[model samples]
Target chain A: MADVGDLVGRARDGEPRAVARLISLVEDAHPRLREVAAALTPYTGNAQVVGLTGPPGVGKSTSTSMLLTALRAEGRRVGVLAIDPSSPFSGGALLGDRIRMGEHATDPGVFIRSMATRGHLGGLAWATPQAVRVLDAAGFDVVLIETVGVGQSEVDVVRLADTTVVLLAPGMGDGIQAAKAGVLEIADVFVVNKADRDGADVTVRELEQLVSMTRREVRGRSWRQPVVRTVAAEGKGADAVVRALAGHRAWLEEHGELRRRRVARASGEVEAVAVQRLRAELGELRGGERLAQLAEAVVGRELDPYAAADALVAELRRG
Target chain B: MADVGDLVGRARDGEPRAVARLISLVEDAHPRLREVAAALTPYTGNAQVVGLTGPPGVGKSTSTSMLLTALRAEGRRVGVLAIDPSSPFSGGALLGDRIRMGEHATDPGVFIRSMATRGHLGGLAWATPQAVRVLDAAGFDVVLIETVGVGQSEVDVVRLADTTVVLLAPGMGDGIQAAKAGVLEIADVFVVNKADRDGADVTVRELEQLVSMTRREVRGRSWRQPVVRTVAAEGKGADAVVRALAGHRAWLEEHGELRRRRVARASGEVEAVAVQRLRAELGELRGGERLAQLAEAVVGRELDPYAAADALVAELRRG
Candidate 1:
């Protein structure tokens, strides 16, 4: 472990390697995380974190690359933290070139990092929020965190971004099934990607209605959610998607939501880490006599899981 | 707050209202869950819990309906837990009046239950496994737990079943996307539903290759993964799915994997409940001076979340 001061300084100086190292430290749960976070705090919160999530076979990666091009054209330094299933199959095929991700291979303004889930209960683990913090502090103007599927974990993933873009492809039979999947609640911007496909217009119309209905269902929201169309294979409609994101950002700031969202995001990250540590503490007790007895009691139905959990928490606290 | 004994007795008599009441008790986190579990324990371990899960719009409900017919024809009492995204559109359309689900509402041999995610991080949640206990103890011969998609939560959903079936439709390009989505690891049986559609053979071939590859990758599996094709809408190949599930169950029993899987499932349910209770305890601490101070410390980076979490857990213990 190098000096935190040097690493922070290098990261702030826009060194991709240094930025990557810092993110690694966070993901690896470095013992000095407190110091690292404290040191990086001054350099944080500038990046507009955007989350791109949808079902598989949707043009999530394609739309992402297209958005990357548009954002870069506008001269914004971008960072991407792709959650699992952003594999070479999805992104690399659309991204076309994965020679090397962060340095020496791609555009200088663009930085790409792929995250693989290590069988974590939530797809976005404790590491993702921390890693996002690293990218934020490293001065990425707009950081993109892309994940597949609109499941409960996607809701958590929304915590990593200020604006979340839900991508949908046309002719999936069930129009806007993304909303049905509970993603409508968390999405800020919806992208009907692969707009060149058949039934694109119908999909767009359905999304318009779904977005409005959901927006009304969720009361007191000052910002209206917008649906944008994209055909990322040829990069058409990519600029509109970027514009929509920026518009939402502006709306967030105008309504004093940006700071509030950041606070919520930070608290969420804090709570996630807290839960992770407690789980770790529990795992640490697995081989011990206490957990075994407690598990036995639970499995035997002599004690319900909640009651046994209370006893286990009490025992862990004693330690 | 009624007598736990009375509730259990009524639930055991196959009363729909009693069954629904028992499930509600679990979902609402009833304080009497301990006694309820103890009462139900004697009747469990008899039901064959098969999990059917896959992407949305894969005809899960249609397949489930067909399975109910086949299982009922075999004189088996079946329970279905459709875990979310089982839209009324599918169940009611293909099912033709989802009034009470599956073969003329008054059928006693089939019980259909749908579990919705109530903002739980994982789609399955604590209520699900406990509800499964309620159903199992109610003497359902086969409990089919169906969930949608391959999110992290779906992985958790797999723990609730002895055999997990992965359903995929053909022409959803990249024949093995299900494998890529982390479904392969949790799948024991693969069903390429909508087999009458074009490219069905291609999808089956791809899944066959994927199953073998994954089997080898996983290592030490005594039973082989099988791919079954079905056009669930017309009830085509429904018996084969039922047979495949039975075969998997038989293999599990012969290899002594069934008992192991049950133990694993019970332990997993225990762990999830414990974690949920701990989280609830933590949530209860919010707005208190201690939690506020700790959250402030973490957000301010004065203390890492791990240390703050330790203090919070210790405080909970003291209380």
Candidate 2:
């Protein structure tokens, strides 16, 4: 086994292989995860963590790459964490993001890694904060977390970031979906990608109306959700996205919401870890034995599921 | 303040008001949830739980009403649970499902209710199985759960049902998304609604190929997902859909998969409940006290999040 301190030291020295190996440890749930996290904690909080998400085929990868280029031109070291919520059917999936971002493979100042979240162990929500810390500590000035805007868990991952960007496309199904569900509140900044496509103006107008409707005076929410347009494939309006991100960041900092948001993030992480830990401990306390009995009781209609669950909780607590 | 047994009794007698109250308790996470579950336990497992899901604009509600018509034609009492994963921005939202199913409002043999998952307490995944039990015990011969096909929690709700129907429209962009994600694996039957539209055949063929690819001899899975066509707006092809459901039901019973699926469902419910219970318990025992300290420790970089999380777990165990 590689020495944890050595790996951390090499990562701090900006060694790419060491950074990759450390992330591997994070993904594999390595035994030395506690040690690795402790060693890397001090170097965190320096990177500006930004998350980008959108429905599939909305050019999320294109926007991410363009943002990377714009950020890189400013001489900032950037790291990208692209995650696909792993599905049951697709065993060895070929992600579109990987192919889309292939041009940046040889860029030394840029680090990119792909994660497939099978929700094993603590799952993506747990693994991501730790992984972000790794990249943050490894001297990335900006860390970008991108996911296909599908699944609750995937959306939850972006919530941990300092700023969240929700992307939409024109003349497709994305605009209606964003309207149907809870997409309004999640977007700190919205980017209408594929701006060259037909009905782009309609999509923009529709989004503007939704944003205005959300930031109504009755609710008393101060921060306005800004919708920017970008043809990411052509690198058009990429600068506008970066400007919008900075504008949101400034607003967050000015309103003292950044500190509050970070605290909430920290509190959430602690709770998530605690919950996952308790779950594992309970699983070892003859949980399967008791669970089988309780489940059988439920199936036989002898006891309600709530009662069985209460009994199981008591058993684990006693253990 | 109604007695749990009384409410269950009234619900079993097809009292719409009582049924509505019981489901409201389910939604509100009423303190009497445990008692309600116990009272309704024996009367469950009689209803055929059919889950219908598809991407937005795929006509899930339309098909649900049509299916309700077909099932009611056979003199079977039917209940509907249409859930919208509640968005943070939309409070008191007017759900499309409720409006679409409005025509069946006066039908004595049908009960349709809507649930919005704000993830209060145990979340929709934990709450839904119990809710289904309530409807089942209320003497409904069939319970149909209709949800917009987005996010993992929404999809997980379908897994609790006996048969899952994945709906698709001809022109809307659901086919690619379903193919990209794991929807193919979760589907037992596919409904190609809006069959009169152009490209309906292509959509059917696409689903057929994807479903076939999933059920290879190497996997040793014998179940083949059947695709049925429907023009739900005009009530065309509803009988074919009903026949398809019955065929799948017979297949499930003959193959002994029904009992196994229910057992698995029971087991999952038990686990979900245990996890939620443990989370709440851990929240006690000076829960907020240790959480703040741990969050501070993690933020200060004195301890890595993993180590801080480990320490928090230790504190909870000690409590």
Candidates in order, TM-scores: namely: 0.82, 0.85
Tens digit of lDDT per residue, candidate 1, span B109-132?
677776666554334656777888
lDDT of 2: 0.80
Which window of 10 residues has the lowest lDDT sum in candidate 1 chain A? A85-94
Index of the highest-DockQ prediction: 2
Query: Which ten-residue region of model 1 chain B has the weakest summed lDDT?
Result: B88-97
Considering just chain B, what TM-score does every model have? Answer: 0.88, 0.92
User: A1-319 in candidate 2: lDDT tens per residue?
Assistant: 6888888889888899999998888888887787888778778778888988877678888899999999988998999998766643332332756777888888888999888765356677677887888999999998999987655667778888899999888876556568667787678898999998899999999989888887733124487888899999899998898899899888878777776667667777767777776666655667456677778799899888888887877776566
Candidate 2 residues B1-319, lDDT tens each?
A: 8888998999998899999999889778787888998899888888888998887677888889899999999999999888766643222332755776888899989998888776466666677887788888999998898877655567778878999998888876556667767778788999999999999998898888888787723135487888899999999999999989899889888777887778778877877777876676556647457666767777776766767677766765566
> What DockQ does each listed candidate score?
0.25, 0.36
User: Scoring only chain A, what TM-score does candidate 1 earn?
Assistant: 0.87
Per-residue lDDT tens digits for candidate 1, residues A226-307, read 8888888888998888889989999888777776666666666666776776776775775655555665665555766567
Interface RMSD, in order shown: 5.1, 4.1
When summed lDDT is taken over every stretch of 10 residues in candidate 2 chain B, the lowest stretch is B85-94
